[model samples]
Target: MSTGAAADGGVHDFGCRGGDPAASAVSGRVSGTGEGKVRSLAWNQGTTLLRAWRAGVLPRRKKLLMTNTNAPSSAASLGLLVLRVVVGAIFAAHGAQKIFEYTIPGTIGSFADMGVPLAEIAAPVVAFVELIGGILLILGLLTRPVGIVLAIDMAVALILVHLPAGLWVGDGGYEFVAVLGVAALALALTGAGRFSVDGAVLRGRAPAWLS
Candidate 1:
């Protein structure tokens, strides 16, 4: 005799009577028991296989499905986190030096000498963008908008300042500024990841404009 319990707490037993191995009878029923108790009892022997699959006892197929579904998002999140920190630190240091005279021009007059066009206007503006954008980028707050502005700022530098020198860093060319512009543009296109303040705000509620 073989026995089992059903989900609704009913008990079932299967047994053979007399000398017939093929001839089987259930005590309170027939070839089956449990009497409507086994709600998930699938109709065929193949049902056992299906149950095993639902329980994750089948590894090969499940693994393939999980891998294909989740891998790309994981990789992108990692890439975004890396880019955020590196870019932030680079901007912060450059801005600090300009703003505080820690390394370069103490004020607008020195910047004018460096041929930064209209230094009276451009110096403070550039310093504010670099300083404020760097801080926001590091905190991952308002990442998309900040990234957009920073990207534009870098693009302007590449066009107005660096392009005159050609392509090589040795030639004071567009190489560095162009690369920075692209990085900021990429961040603008994709918001910060789950580890960011921007992500927290996004999860709470959709921004008004997003609706």
Candidate 2:
């Protein structure tokens, strides 16, 4: 025969062929007393504890998961801001050198030497675009359109001046122009990010093209 203790502290016997009188008496006493009620109360308390633990732990886990996911996006916004500012500064410096230091006539002469078509007209136009666009880029004003214009300008310089020299900038190659062009293209596609004037002005309600 196998014997086991019940939740009510009663002993039960299995395989009692003759139906053991002692086991039957103990079962009747437990059922008639307050032990069964005490067991029910303990079971309810255990169930309540389990439910409370789940309620407390689940929200905490969800919050931790959300924090981990959001961290990378915050870092990306900062990265984009850094990229925009640095590239804008470089373009601005180059533009200032061409317009102020080199002089328009000198720039035209250089363009002519480089075999640029319509050097006289193209020289002033390129200089103006670079100077004004660079300033606008730094201010994050009209970012996407300005980025497109700068990208095209760099692409032209690459095709006409740098491509023939090869890939290394030290050898007068297209490396610098290619990098500038790709950066401009990226800006054109991504816009200025949350740190930009565009973001401040738009306030997350901008049109698709503007962004």
Candidate 3:
């Protein structure tokens, strides 16, 4: 973390505007301190900013925005709640359809027809996992685990039943499962957000990976 200005030739005006007061003032002061440090000072409207870097580093105007460090906004939580409700309901409905409407025997027959391996074993597991996971998701409890399981469930459906049909859902393609998988994976990674039961209990006290 060395600190000093760059050499004269190192300074470049990034402001675009000609004769900018801040750029003009800093022009003459740019000079290397011979300690492998670089710094820049810019001022406008009686405000001053000084930044330093080492190891040939320089200031940057563009930065990656992949992370969100600020506290979750209420609107964001609301959005998460909506997403959870809708997606969870869909999953739960599918699960219920398998167990009640189709029945275990029927699901097994369908799985067998689709050439799914171990249809006898997988039928019940997939049904209960979706039902339980979907309920958990709706309640915002154990969301991450539920999300992962559901995502995997969707992935298996894609591979076994949907992928070979092409990209359109009308053709029985994987598009629907793919969307559900990504959505579930997103929930797994993001957790239930501030509107969830996890938020009410964890409150920053839970382990990072779990939270």
- TM, every model: 0.60, 0.64, 0.67
Best by lDDT: 2
Of 1 and 2, the candidate ahead on TM-score is: 2
lDDT of 1: 0.73
Task: State each model's CA lDDT, in order.
Answer: 0.73, 0.83, 0.78
Residue by residue across 1-211, what tens digits does model 3's lDDT show? 1224458556444442464657644643453332224222323322333333332223332122223444567888788888888888889888899999999999999999999999999998998888878888887887887898899999999988999998899999999989989988988988888888888997578775565
The residue-level lDDT of candidate 1 at 195 comes to 67
User: Which regions of candidate 1 deviate over 4 angstroms?
Assistant: 1-72, 102-107, 204-211
Task: Please provide, for model 2 over 97-184, each residue's C-alpha lDDT reduced to its tens digit, 9 standing for 90 to 100.
Answer: 8899999999999999999999999998999888888887787777898899999999999999989999999998999988888998
- Tens-place lDDT digits, model 1, residues 97-154: 7788733345577667657788778777888888888888877788788888889988
* Model 2: colliding residue pairs: none
Order of candidate numbers by TM-score, starting with the best:
3, 2, 1
Error of 1 at 91 (Å): 1.0
For candidate 3, the C-alpha RMSD (Å) to the true structure equals 12.1
RMSD (Å) of each candidate, 1 decimal: 13.0, 9.6, 12.1
**Which of 1 and 3 is ahead in TM-score?**
3
Rank the candidate models, highest lDDT first: 2, 3, 1
- Show the colliding residue pairs in model 1: 26-30
